[model samples]
Target: MIDIPSMQRAGANAVKAIIDDVISEKLDVEKKFSSSKTAFRIADLGCSVGPNTFIAMQNIIDAVQQKYQSQGFASHMPEFQVFFNDHTSNDFNTLFASLPPERPYFATGVPGSFHGRLFPDFSLDFVHSSFALQWLSKVPEELLSKNSAAWNKGRVHYASAPDEVAQAYTVQFAKDITTFLEGRAKELVVGGLMVLNMPGIPNGNPHSSSVTGLSFDILGHCLVDMAKEGLISEVQVDSFNVPIYVASPKEMT
Candidate 1:
């Protein structure tokens, strides 16, 4: 498994802010769910192996319950059906094994890519993704083609890449995000809520100078060192690139 304590810590730190924002938008939830008498259907997109996913889902459930109760609809509280989605190759057995016995909602695993259609139209009431959208569906094909202007030579990502390479990645990210939104739009019911949390570059900051960019630079240096030590070939390093892009808020909008 990918053991990154810092990553988990960062995710935990952001959870409160995310939950608060979602709760503050209770008016929207009330509007959507007030008339519904059926079980609430929630989909946690890109929800990887758990603890964090559990916390997020519980917070959403609590927020929804509180919203309905505040509206004097305590008797109308709906059952929850939570779907944890991830790639087909993900270790779903491990994810399901760690579920808490006291979970308030019924849970199931949905293995598929979020960049494409994974559910039927208008079937979901809430959707969430955390620290996941930065991952592109696939690397930009142009970056790997020697004849393409966006050839990403001597690098694994767009951190210090040339303008053309950076542009290629940016274009690819836009396309992926568009596909993701389109898929979600078709799946979610009217007034449904979607919360997406991803790494982003600040406005007025250079993309290559951001904290995430710098981290990628350090990783690239390590890969270069490995190549020098004959642990891997320089050509392999040049050919391989991370299918991740830290977009700006403006880009997302």
Candidate 2:
């Protein structure tokens, strides 16, 4: 059984703090942020199947609502929409089926990556991607553009991978970040915020299979073992991944 709840909470806590601190402190621009009734517009990118995503979404909604109500508009609450996103492999039925109908919030699933834009132009205010950006896309076909080795299909996990392999994965991730930031920038109306949190080892990452570098390795391995046991057909893990984000307070503002 996967502890999706705990995993969701850990990630959600990051967003919660970011939202709260932003609302309380100086997020982008307070006057600009407060000008709208929405208070905060957010998206949970890479939110997989589980109750945790919903809880986190609800937490953000509640916080934003409270922020709005305290502003003296308790009767006329603002509208908000948070799109839950993930790869095509994610269990959308499970995620949507589990969505609590009692909540008065708009939610939907965007089939793609948080690293990719899911909404139309200028359609968001805040974006939260937790614990998911670390996993690079399977691999780019042109990984060998500069004569690098091809990424094998069975090489599961990115921790402790060869330098070149890791570089390939890292480069792909950078492309994703470029896509994500560029897309979000177009959608955000000047004062939007994006909070991206994932597992990363500061500067001690070395090329080795036993790198125990990221906590996500545990989740990925469970999937690997399932594949090994024939529970899941095959495994195609990236040999390298660099868990780094390219967002700053200046860029978000």
Candidate 3:
């Protein structure tokens, strides 16, 4: 049960630029809609429990409304239907309960991974995901195999692991990203817009220099310390690893 607000602040800050870019971009909403009666469908991928998701959706809606007003369609504002997506095991109940009574859009919960198809073909006009793609569908299988070249033992992520271990995570991330994009491509309309914001390391910078990587290392050390004190078994610490992979900008491209 991590503090959702505090955990999401960094990601929220990182994506502000991208969100602004989307808002400023020429969306041609009126032309995209053509008919005045079409409902604008927006999907927030990986929208975990919270107020952060609400804020993000609100920003997007407000920006779109501004665009509509500028285009002389203020009188015929289309209805908005927003889909909040996340893994099936996510605390959707808490998310629903926390919804503001004054919410302007019709919100629906879509439970599933974003790595695969979650919507009908050409049904979505906009898609947003923040700090969510960093999570792989699952940890690389080779990392868990003792005999594998990428075996990541006594460590959690590829931060300080061998090159092969890092490569394995990179390969998995690429695969997952490909799947995510391909799925979204099928779901979004021809002129649809998608905005994604995820943590990325600078080019040529060692993972250790990144805050996230350093934090993982510190957590690993803490776990080892706990094991040494017999509060937790060393074997347990050795077997556990986080499923997140922080990619570089080049890797993303």
Candidate 4:
């Protein structure tokens, strides 16, 4: 089985590498911002209640400072303002309580789905999302429609399902991604960078081949068994679907 924390660590390391190499050239630190604050703005979209988000944000702050120092602009270093965004149901209190006591950045919690616009135009200097995009806004409605060809009768995910079911998920994902990209495009300032770290399968591979897919398959079977044993209704089992779409590399492109 693939360890989730390991994957998250790998993504964080990749983010660090990108920031170290290109951030200095890509971002214009001296540019006059529309906001009156003396702080550099960063948004971590889909940041769950965790220490990993803190680690990633710190890495960014350090890299930005290094960039300024290397360019002999250390005396005018900007304060850091970090926005931690996630679903409204997330435990913001816990996230705030666990923050590092001596952290340099001023943190704020923003609750909303990243698929929609959450920030004002040209508001963010850098944006980051880690291991969060697989979750769709909601389960594809076709999967729950008895009259639809894509109805996922006994399954809780697209994996190992019929082509119609998978296609339904793909279409929904495409729409959701378009909305997400448009929002980010409007939110990020000119010369700003956005780093996204999401799970994906290799090109030409079926989602069912991955561990996540297999886990969903197992869950679907368990639910079916439960229905058979009268623990849940068959209709309920038919209506339930996991709102995640683990895209392949091709799908992502």
User: Against the true structure, candidate 4 has what lDDT?
Assistant: 0.87
lDDT per residue, candidate 4, 1-253, as tens digits? 4676778878888778886766777767667333344678899998888788998899889988898888777887889899999999999999999999999999999999999999999888889889889889988888888999999999999899999999998999999988999999999987788888888888888879977899899999999999999999999999999898888877767
26-77 per-residue lDDT for model 2 (tens digits): 3433354456554445678888885767777776667666766667655666
- What are the per-residue Cα lDDT tens digits for candidate 1 across 1-253? 2344457447755775776667556436456555656778898888888878888888888888887787687787789999999999988999999998999999999999999899999988889888889999999999898999888877888988888988988999999999999999999888777888777887757778977777777788898999999999999988999898989888987
Q: Write the per-residue lDDT of candidate 3 for residues 1-253, one digit (tens) a residue.
A: 3444666766676676667667667577667667556888899999999788888888788878888888787887778899999999999999999997998899999999998899999999889987788899998899877789887766777787789988888889899999999999999987888988777789999877877778788888888899889999877776677788888888877
Local distance difference test, each candidate: 0.83, 0.62, 0.84, 0.87
The runs of at least 3 residues in candidate 1 whose Cα sits more than 4 Å from the true structure, single-residue gaps closed, are: 1-9, 12-15, 23-36
TM-score of each: 0.92, 0.69, 0.92, 0.92
Question: Using lDDT as the measure, which candidate wins?
Answer: 4
RMSD of 3: 2.0
